[model samples]
Target: MSTPATSRARGVERIIDIFRQLHAARRPMTMRELIVATGAPRSSIYELVAIFSEAGWLETSGDGSVFFGREMHYFGADYAAHNDLISRAHQSILSLVRKHDETAQLCTLEGNKYTVMLSESSSRPFNISSDIGVKVPIPWTATGRLLLGHLNVNEIRALIPDEDFVLENGTRIAFDDFLRDVQYADAQGYCCTEGLSHTFRLCMAAPIRDRSGVAVAALCFMTSRDTDPKKRELMLDDLIKSAKALSEPYSRL
Candidate 1:
C-alpha cells in the first residue's frame, strides 16, 4: 500500500538513520550491525551502503567495517565556513576561555533538550567541559532557562516532557520555580545556577538574541562551585557583554 512518494521518503529516512547510527557508535560498523541498528531489511541496507560508499559518503575498512568518509568532513567544514553565527560564536567562546581560563560553550535548544553546539575547554588540569552534541534535559542547565525565556508559560510547559523535570540526583524541580527562573533570566539578561546538573559545578549563561530579540542561542561558562562570588560576578558581566556582541546584526559583524 506504499505509494512511490512514501517509498522514496522512507528510503531517505533510512539513509539518515544509517548516518545517525554510525555517529552514535563513534566507530565503523559492519553490514549486519548497520542492519540491526537501522532496523532496515538486510538487502535494502546492503544496497544503500553500496551506493553511499561509491558516492564517498561512507567508506569501507580492510576488515569490512564501514565509517564516515572524507566527504562528510568536507561538508561539515563547508557548513562552518558559511554559517556566520557558528563561525562567530566559535571565536567568541575561544576568546572567553582564553581570558577567564574556564570552560566556555555555545549552546542552543535541540528539540526539548539543551545541546552544546561548541565548546572551548580551559587549559587548567581541572575543568568542567560538556560533550558536544549530547542532548541534556533542559531543566538541568542555566542556559535552558535563558533559551526558553521567550516562551509563554503554557508553551514552555507543553514543550518540555514531564519526566525531564527530574534531575540526575532524583530531585524534581517545581514547575512554578522553573517558570519564575525563566522570567527572572529574561529580565536580568543573564542567569546562574550552582549544583543543578553537577554537584560541584557553577553555570552562568547569557542569551544570544536574534533580530526579533528572542534568544536563539546562549553563551555560557562552567566553573568550580567554590569560585569566589566576586569572581563569579566579573565572569558573568563579561559573558553578558560577549553574548550581546554576538547577537548584533550579521551586517554589523
Candidate 2:
C-alpha cells in the first residue's frame, strides 16, 4: 500500500527511467517498449507518458513512438546557460578541441559511474564519440580512476563495486591495481590511461577541485593511440592546464 506522495514519487522515478531508456536507444520508443524497459505497470506508464507528452517534455510520433520533445531541449539549454561549471568548462574544452584536434570532455562521478557532462568533438577525421550524459562503469574510464583521487583507499573500495572492474570488453582489473591507479593520481595530481575503455584511443584526465580541494569533476582529452609519445605528453600537459583553469574559479565557490 503506497500513499499518494509515494505513488507520485514512484511515477517521477519511472519517468526518469523512461527518458534514460529512450536516450540509450538513441531513438523513439513505443509504449510497450517503455513498459518492458522500465518494468512499470502498463496503466502507470500510459498515464505518465500522457502527462509528459502533454507538457511537451515528450512527443509521440505517428507510429506511436515517443521521444524527447522540443521543450526538453529548451530545458537542457536553459540548464547549460545557468550552470557556471558547464559554461566555463565548455569554453576550456573547445580550446582543447581547436588546439589538439581531439575530443575534449568534462566528466563527473555519479554513484558507481561517470557521466560526460559536456564535450567538444575533434575536427580530425577520427574522433572519440563520448555521448554526453551517458553513464558508464567508473572502473572502465581513465577519468573515473582519477576522479576517485579525492577519496582514500577505504572509501574508494567501498564506493566501487567488485563487478565494475569486469568491463564490457571482459577485462577484470584487480582491485589492488585499480587502487594503485587512484593513489597515483592522488599523489601525481593527474593521470593518463590508454586503451582501458576504448581500445582505439587514449584519455588523459586532471582533477577540477573545489574550494575545499575536493575533486568535483574532471577535464579530459582524447587522442588516437597512434600519437607519438612526445605529442601525447604535450596533449596531456594542455589537458592539465585546462583542468586547472576550470578548477581555479570553482575554488572560490
Best model number under TM-score: 2
Q: Give the alpha carbon lDDT tens digit for every residue of 97-120 in model 2.
A: 888788889998878888898988
Q: Estimate each model's TM-score.
A: 0.91, 0.94
TM-score of 2: 0.94
For residue 237, give model 2's deviation from the true position in Å. Answer: 1.4
lDDT of 1 by residue, 102-135 (tens): 9999998989999998899999999997888788
Instruction: Please give the lDDT score at residue 6 for candidate 2.
Output: 97
* Candidate 2: pairs in clash: none
lDDT of 1 at 9: 99
List ranges where model 1 is wrong by over 4 Å. Answer: 251-253
What lDDT would candidate 1 get against the real structure? 0.91
